[model samples]
Target: MIRKRKHVISIGISATFLGIFFFFITLNNVHTDTYDIARFSTAGETIRSPITIENEQETERKTRETVQSVPDRFNISTEITQERVNYIEEVFDAIATLESEELGEKENEDDKETNGDRLVPLSNQEKVNRLKQILSEPITESLENETLIQLIISPQDDREAGRKLFVENLETVLNNGVRTENIQSAISEINQSIKYATLNEELKQPLTELSKFAVVENSFFDVEQTQEARKEAASNVDPVVIRAGEVIVQEGQTITNEIYEELNLVGLLDGQRNFFPAIGLALLIFLICSMIGYELYLLMKENKLEKGKLISIIGISILIISVLKLVSLFLTSENQIFYIVPIATGAFLLKLLINERVAIIFTALFSIISGIIFNGEIAGSLNIEAVIYFFFSQLAALTFLTNVKDRTSILKSGFGVMVVNIITILLFVFLTFEKYDLIDLLIQTSFGIISAFLSVVLTIGLLPFFETVLGVLTDIKLLQLSNPNQPLLKKLLTETPGTYHHSVMVANISETACEAVGANGLLARVGAYYHDIGKTVRPQYFIENQMSNRNPHDFIDPKESAKIIISHPYDGAKQLKKYKLPKEIIDIAEQHHGTSLLKFFYYKEKEKEKEREEVGQIDESIFRYPGPKPQTKEAAIICICDSVEAAVRSLNEPTEDKIEEIVAAIINDRMTDGQLDESPLTLKELKIINRTICGTLKGIFHSRIQYPLKEAK
Candidate 1:
């Protein structure tokens, strides 16, 4: 009932924790929009539009200044028309001037150079003059036509200058009286073409109008401008504030002005009713608590501790986990740290308080709870990789701890943790991470491995404190008990030599038998050496401690003898408890005899009962041992060893055959009486145990002839 009450209270505490965890989760999600204010807001205010009144005024002023600074547009068509007319007039005047020059040059060469080289030929001179005339004709005519067009149009002074020069040259050529009919004809054709110059004026008007229309028009609003304006508007708005306990939003509902305003002010809000997150939190709490409970069960069940100790162990474990959780939270926002703490705690607990299997279960529970608490970014949500890593790291740490005793084993176990952690991390990265790179992946793996190793060291350091404070009987505690120098074992050897010797033999036999059947041989041997230690209270009363003396029990009544024999198991149990022997060994000491009858005492009592027929029926239960039969193979083996050793010792001249028969008889008797019924030993295993015991006893009691040595004179 007390145990049930403690469990109920523990469950209640776990449930309360779970409830709070879920409440927080729900509050966070429903208030997410409020939370998003942190992302949206700048400083203590909302992000604002860029187009403020000052900015708009500045833009208008800049636009006005830009318009004033820009140069006025000019019409290219009007300018081109005047320039073309002037160019035509200039070409015609130049043609007329070139014709006059050609005629003069030909007349001079003919009159002055004839006698220079046997007189130039008239035909050659005529051909040269004609070629010069042909070239000058187009030039002179083109100039005359340009000058005439410029005169007719009264073109701009800048355009008419070249045409005026050409006309002057044409007049100079014509006054020379050189016959130039072809040049005059060309000039006349050019003059007729001068009428087309007015077309330029018509084209210029529409071109200038098109240029004026092409100027860009400013607009009241543009998309880019609007965005900037909105930004400025948002920036000008003040931040909103919300205090704790204010309902920022409701679940499954659209956000409202109140929610938005509150969120905007404070830059955060808690979640609302989120069922999945709440359920996940609840499950996480349950898993962690359940793991802790199961670990307590493992320790208690192994040590066979009483209800009080069981409660204390469980309470201490819960307290440790809680403290670790608190420490994990206080450390930082790094969720990996949370995982590291629990994993390390579990590993240390396994090394110090329980076995690796229990540690592994503990790690699993911690990983899940951590995922929920840290929200799965690090520990991973339903993360198969995280689960696998937790299991593998726990297994690695635990497996490497086999037969660990000293500080050096801690170092070795740490190395093992590193190896396993690396493998698990690699597996996770490859299987889960998408943007995988060798260097980053390796770094993550290395960090995990190093953390795992450090956890091992920390756990080893903390183990002794927990063991001493909690008075927990861990496997390490058992190993310590198995040491040869313990005071009780030393006292047993010194005070009662015969019993000590008997215990040593029983240790050997029991250890071998238990080992043969895959039981805890160290525990079996240790327990066997201490089982009959209470016989030292009256050493001579038990035959094993009688040292060649007459049997004292022979003088006592059979009922009294049976009473003395039956009292030893209980007495041994008490003595062991008084000395603080672990419950497992004490149970072995108490239950080794089970309820088997004392044959000699039983037969003698039957004879006495026949003599006193009127006496009430004998209570056979009283004659038998007060026993809870051997529940484990180790306890069963110890029982068999005790009986076989006593029976074998009774022989005056022990031989191999006799030892075998005696050992077999003890097994058959125990089996026939159903003392072995509750033990896990199978019939096949029992047969093997019997054969092993017979073989061992044969070697112990082997036959040898004694020879007399003669003395020489």
Candidate 2:
């Protein structure tokens, strides 16, 4: 176990190192200078114009100027000036003085004229015209243009006051003796100015006040516009470009510092050279090693030195695969060529040296390793196209033809590989590189097909060497063993007729039992045939061989008799090993008897002991066979069949009902005693096994009657 663990740890470390090494090496080999050429296809192609810093600044300035040109109604300054205050006061004083004088005159006229009366209201149009004339009669000619004016009087009062003021101003102006046309023009100009001044002041005052409190001093030169200009400038700058299908360097291009820098900038350079490829190579090696380890585990499961053998197998297989990979590399710079050779070699080796399933699995793994190695050159980087081509080609080659017994199937498989490879390559090309030129596509397609055919041919050629070197008993070898004409089975049939007959019956019972419970029936049947061959060593000592002789147990002590009976399972195991049988067959031989007691001998000993002393010491366990128990259902079923067959042969008369009762009793005894616990057979499956055993026994042990000729006598 310790050795096995150490081997596993070693393989794990090796695989890890290999994967990292290959990754770096592949990364280093990648051409960084080619990227720029690949990005930009042709020399004469014109690039887009770039935006300069000056241009951006000019655009920003223009945007600011446009925002500033929007018109506004007010100036923030002079809205609350001393000139405006003075103008308001002067207008108020003038109106007050004019009202006082008019009122005084009216009061005097009223006193003289006998009766006082209220003034009549004027029409709105007349009042408005009169108010316009009054405002034109400038008592506030010194007022600033920026003064705020508001007419606070009621409409009726405003009209009346305006009319009175206008008449007074007209009398004053006429008294100055101005010409009529000049006066009219002057009045019209004054009226227009007054109206405009009043409205302008009203509009300007509020805007001026609002402007003082506004948060932004200027609405021009916004943040959003500035950012947009910067983005536009950046976008207009030219991007680095590259083009496809251009080799920037030749095969012998020097590994210079400039090239290294460029590769590093593009994240393609590896500091440690050769590491990436080595790591990739190591993964393939490790996988092969693991497969060998698993096979060894299967082979050595029943041996005492299982762990040691398993480790040795893994180590040896790794060394072999690595050597093969290295040799292929020396032969071809193209990894695809190397990949084809190893997989073909591995598959053929596995078919002959190991089982076909193991061979198929190894082939699959090799194909994947090939794809990794050939990716950049054959299929362009570690892509699905390369993987698919490798997988389908390998699968077609392995599964299309069977029985690598001769060179014919190998040739047939090579043809099948070509067909499959071509199809796979076409599929990959169509999916990945949509534009297909007939000539280039066909050449690449042919390469894949030819590689697959070569792989099959090479695999076929290597099979015999692997088989001879490894001493592997493959499925094909086992199949050959099954032939009736084999020397070993022929010898057994001739020399030990009764044992051969017993073996045949045991095979039937074991196969049926295995099948009923979904175990390997063929293996079970084969194992049962070889399980009791050890009995041939002392054939006369066994009851089946001593057919017409006296019983051998008559003169023996019951304890000694039981000991001989129990030793048969161990003896059978030893004989099977001498013949170089598989561990599975030996296991069935050793466990068929389990730890069952020889009841007749045990009871006889018990009765004799009771007569000899008041209470004698007795070891009941001595009567039972030594056992590791039946680990498989087939072995357990064979045990039952062996007992039932022997028991029924001794019966004078047998019936179907009687046979069933005896079979049920024996099965129930086994279940109660935990004899069948190790076997995975459930209660339901056991019932089926029991019924099959009884039915078979009944057929073999059917009743036969002796005929009497009394009438002729």
Candidate 3:
């Protein structure tokens, strides 16, 4: 139920954050301004489009023009050309038939009279009528009476020659597509061909007249093809779009109908409902928050999620977004004000206070959000330049801020960010091809330089507040605590020098061992330094601090000595809590002993009880330190190192072999004693830890060269 409550609260917090983000993003997008101006009225101020939209009216007009510009498509009919040629052939064939009919009548009449008297030939006028009857109606109607008569009276060879010339020329003229406008010109060309042909002059007139009948408009209008051509032209016409930031009207200029329509098209005019930008902003905020929430879920599953880190993420995100929005107010096309925003500050803080992965994820989110927020010219339009600038700036910080332990590292990284920012700015400037003055160039580069420094400054300032207020122990905090001059550390050094020295040694061993097993080595080291702080409560009771070669436990009762030994862990925990150190540090102080029995006191008491025949009365729990056990890999590692360091220090002659043997034995004893049961350390990690500790101890206790009389010299 408690876990469920945490999830619910976390979800609620995430929802609240998303709501706030949506509100901020929508501030610029959602407009409530009323434009009282009307069409063809003078404008009070220049109006730019708030949103990008297609001018459907203008687009349709352009499409109409484009479609009209396409000429009508027509198909030339080959069948018509062949039919015209056949008509000319029929006229000549009819003339030849008249001659043949006249010759056949002459032969029959000669047979009847027994004399070759000339038979009555068909007259030219009679032949003309007969020819008209034999030919098609279109051919007969097109030719004149005198033209047909002339062709009938002409020699048959002249008629044949005229027919061949007219048919060939007619076919050529008809084959070349003739529309209604060009049909007369085509007929004239065919007539000229007939006039120039090697035909009898009298027949040429008839053939020229025949050419008129042969050439009628062979090419006709094709409605389907014309419609298809227009459709293709319309499809090619691009939509007319009035882009965001485009000037709809200039100040002191008349607002014409076109300009007013454009204003209405882009949703700048009053009564135009535009909810798309707000909807888009809401969706963007939702997506960003969902990703962050998922990251938090992963952290929670890994037991790495703390209230402090969660608050840090929320706080840093809010700070970055608020900064962007505030700066966006100053941002303009003439001035790239977004360049001066300390966007990398969020990346630095997240990396230092929380973790790098979260920093990277939020950096990209910040960059994207910055792009939209810094779009000063218009709402719902992206400034790709801003996105590229912020991303590289933060990415540079993430890349170079490598040593979180060093306080100056953030500043050092700022230099890298500065270089990258300047380069990114220069890239924009050069790529734009627009002329920029020297002052403008300097000012833009200065923004990049200012951004880097500002990020460093803000990150440095915010870190202590988060570390102190949230009770979070970061690497920098650990580094500071490791200083010997720190209050608790100094106290340990001045009051219990022997134990202090032992702590330093244990810290070294624990750090190495923890790192070997992929655990937080710095955390283990810092924890180790404070783990023996409990021993400082009664320093003389601990063997290392009994420097006078005397033991305080010698005079005390075995039960009292055991109680004093066990109380130290809790005593150190109390002092640490009093100082309000982070929970992890206090945990190490409290759990390093891990409920292990004080064997010396326990055995001593057992001996006394055995002598008195009261061994059964002695309880093992009385001699054990009260512990919750080491609950983390670092805490578990500190526990083993703490015992191993103390055990090795007590050895009369510590050697490489002896150190290795004792390290392995101590780790084995801790495992068997179940001191590490609660920790997440695996058997494989334990083996690795064992080897690391042995190597570290062996290095520390390696054989030293003995000097003879040279020492006195």
Cα lDDT listed for each candidate: 0.59, 0.55, 0.84
Question: Over 4 Å off in model 2, which ranges?
Answer: 1-261, 267-339, 342-366, 376-380, 383-385, 397-418, 425-474, 485-488, 607-617, 648-656, 680-688, 691-713
lDDT of 2: 0.55
- Minimum summed lDDT over a 10-residue window in model 3 is located at 25-34
Q: Compose the digit string of candidate 1's lDDT tens values, residues 411-447.
A: 6777787787777666655675477667766667766
C-alpha RMSD by candidate, in order: 15.5, 16.2, 6.9
TM-score of each: 0.57, 0.54, 0.75
Single out the weakest 10-residue window by summed lDDT for candidate 1.
210-219
What value does the lDDT take at residue 590 in candidate 3? 89
State, as a TM-score between 0 and 1, how close model 3 is to the true structure.
0.75
Report the error of model 2 at residue 225, Å: 17
